[model samples]
Target: MKIEGIVLIGIGAFMAVVSVGYWFWSGEPSGTAMLIGAVLLGLLPGGYYYWWAKRMKPRPEDRPDATTREGAGVIGSFPHGSIWPLVFGAGAFLFGLALAFGWWFLPPALGLMLVAATGVTTQSRRGGAI
Candidate 1:
């Protein structure tokens, strides 16, 4: 986590410096905005990982002397299949359509998202399809 954080920060910082130079050269607000966004793309995750790295005990991968066994733990069971993702995609598609076409699609879009959220939550809690 620490290493990941450092790398991300470096990436963000490098982009930021370049963005400053580009801003001065081109004097284009749009270009500066996009470059700053790139800076944020790195800084956000980097800051999160670095914060966690500081809070928790060192992870096995971070230690030079650590072995693979040091990181041993039970792996979690993943969901085999679920329809929630399709439901979400459908909702998102409708939402986009609403934004592009008209406000009438908003209701169905919101409803589908609601249904998906309920189904996924129920499935996780009951360990079965909803």
Candidate 2:
């Protein structure tokens, strides 16, 4: 039903049909190609089943996606998100300054950048989580 499964099925069917056609038309080469095609067809269905089973199965909490209830859709935006953008800009400024000056300032500047990026990401996710 999923797109990946449909694609695999279509590919498998196509390969199988082509292989059969070749077998009737040609000789040893066709037989080799048929073997390869049949192998591919078998693997495709096997992979599809494996993925389906994985999706159908469930696990305990403590997984990153355990609490993810709904599909990933658009969430509400943070009204004050502009502040985070400015924070990121300041971090970039500091980073650039450190680069121009010396390597000694690089660590602090990188730390600032990391903090700014983390704050922005966390704030955005928190504001948007539904």
Candidate 3:
């Protein structure tokens, strides 16, 4: 994480410097905006990882005498198959289709999207498969 953060910061800084140089030479506002966005994008995750590494407890890898077996275990649980994605996809498709077809299709598509989003969000609370 620390290495990744450093790399991201470097990339962002490089982008910003190049963009600023380009803007000065060509006077393009688009490049300036892009550089600003790039800097923010790089800073957000870089800062997050730097903060996270500092705040987190030292892991097995951080210890000089730690064994490989010390890090072997279930890291976390993940959801398998779920129907909510399909529902959401259908709603999205309908919403897009409505843009070219008719405005009347918006209500049902939006409703399905909302319902599916709510169901996915609340599935863990209900102790159901996601």
Candidate 4:
């Protein structure tokens, strides 16, 4: 994570320099603005990851002396065979189809999405064996 964050920050820094040069050379705002946006895309999450990395204990992978066995174990329980995800996909499909079929599909789509979201949340809160 720390290395990842550093790489992203490096990318953002490189882009920033490029953007400045591009702005001066082309004298165009749009391309410079997009380049600036790219800078933010790299920086924002990079900063977040770096910040969290600083606070977290280094993982087995992060440690030089750690063995493969040190990392081999159950990390945490994750949801399996979940139905809410399928329902959410169905709702999302309906929403997309509404663009061509009619505006009438919008309400039902939204409703289905909301219901699925709520169900997933409920299931997650219940913990283990979804």
Candidate 5:
């Protein structure tokens, strides 16, 4: 993770330097903005990873002689299956159809989408399987 953070910071710095060059070459505002945006995109993740590495405790991989087996363990809980995804998909489809059809279809579609989202969010609290 430390190495990853260093690499990301390097990449971000490189992008920023390149953006400066681009701005010097072409004085166009849009192009300059894009270049600056690219620099920002790179820096955001780099900064996040760097901060995370500093804040979090070192993992097994941080050790010089750590083995692959040393890092092996259950990652986290994952849902086996759920019906909410299908409901969400249906709502999405309806929303898309509403856009192509009439205004009357919009309300119902939006309502369905809201309901589906709520169902998915509350399912776990209700002891429902994912």
Candidate 6:
């Protein structure tokens, strides 16, 4: 999370700096306005990182053995052993590619994939072998 915050701040600061440079080079009101907007937005992530890093602390009750400790509900709930995720991801990619490339066969292919995925998911839910 801290790394994410830093990355956000870095991206925002980069946009602000680039906008400022563009404003000076192009002498455009839009660029100057964008610079101000980017800077304001950039401050948000930076401030969030500072506040979170300083304010957050691990309490005694937050230990791993605590019943309410992080991710307690996740234990033994489900094993990370599903192949459906890969199938769904492939279907999504195909769908997106079809949408982008305007292929004639894409729509029907995507629909078939969706139906197959639904069937597989139902079977899994019924405790049948995938």
Error of 2 at 45 (Å): 29
Error of 6 at 79 (Å): 5.0
Which candidate order results from sorting by TM-score in descending order? 4, 3, 1, 5, 6, 2
Checking candidate 5 for backbone clashes, the offending pairs are 81-130
- What TM-score goes with each of the models? 0.73, 0.36, 0.82, 0.84, 0.73, 0.41
Q: Per-residue lDDT of 1-130 in model 3, one digit per residue for the tens?
A: 5666787888778877887888899898987888889888887888787778788866787677889899998765467767888999999999999999999889989999999999788875665444
lDDT of 6 at 76: 32
- Model 4 over residues 62-95: C-alpha lDDT tens digits? 8899998999888767866789999999999999
Q: Against the unseen true structure, what C-alpha lDDT does each candidate score?
A: 0.91, 0.66, 0.82, 0.90, 0.80, 0.70
Report the lDDT tens digits of candidate 6 across residue range 43-113.
68776975685677633343446454453443333534666666766777787878788786487658767
Residue 92 miss distance in model 4 (angstroms): 1.2
C-alpha displacement of 4 in model 6, angstroms? 6.5
Q: Listing every candidate in turn, what is its Cα RMSD in Å to the true structure after a full C-alpha superposition?
A: 3.6, 12.4, 2.9, 2.5, 3.3, 7.5
Worst 10 residues of 6 by lDDT: 71-80
Clash totals in order: 0, 0, 0, 0, 1, 0
**Native-vs-model 5 lDDT?**
0.80
Colliding pairs, model 6: none
With candidate 6 superimposed using the best TM-score fit, by how many Å does residue 9's alpha carbon deviate from the native? 3.0
Question: Across residues 1-130, which tens digit of lDDT does each residue of candidate 2 receive?
Answer: 3444656766776767777777677756847676667759755785776588567643323244655564355555646434656766777887888779877777777777788788877776767621
Displacement of the residue 118 alpha carbon in candidate 2, Å = 1.3
Model 4 Cα shift for residue 68 (angstroms): 3.6
lDDT by residue for model 1 (32-81), tens: 99999999999999999999999998878888999879978854546889
Return the top candidate by TM-score: 4
Q: What's the lDDT of the predicted structure labeled candidate 1?
A: 0.91
| Models ranked on lDDT | 1, 4, 3, 5, 6, 2
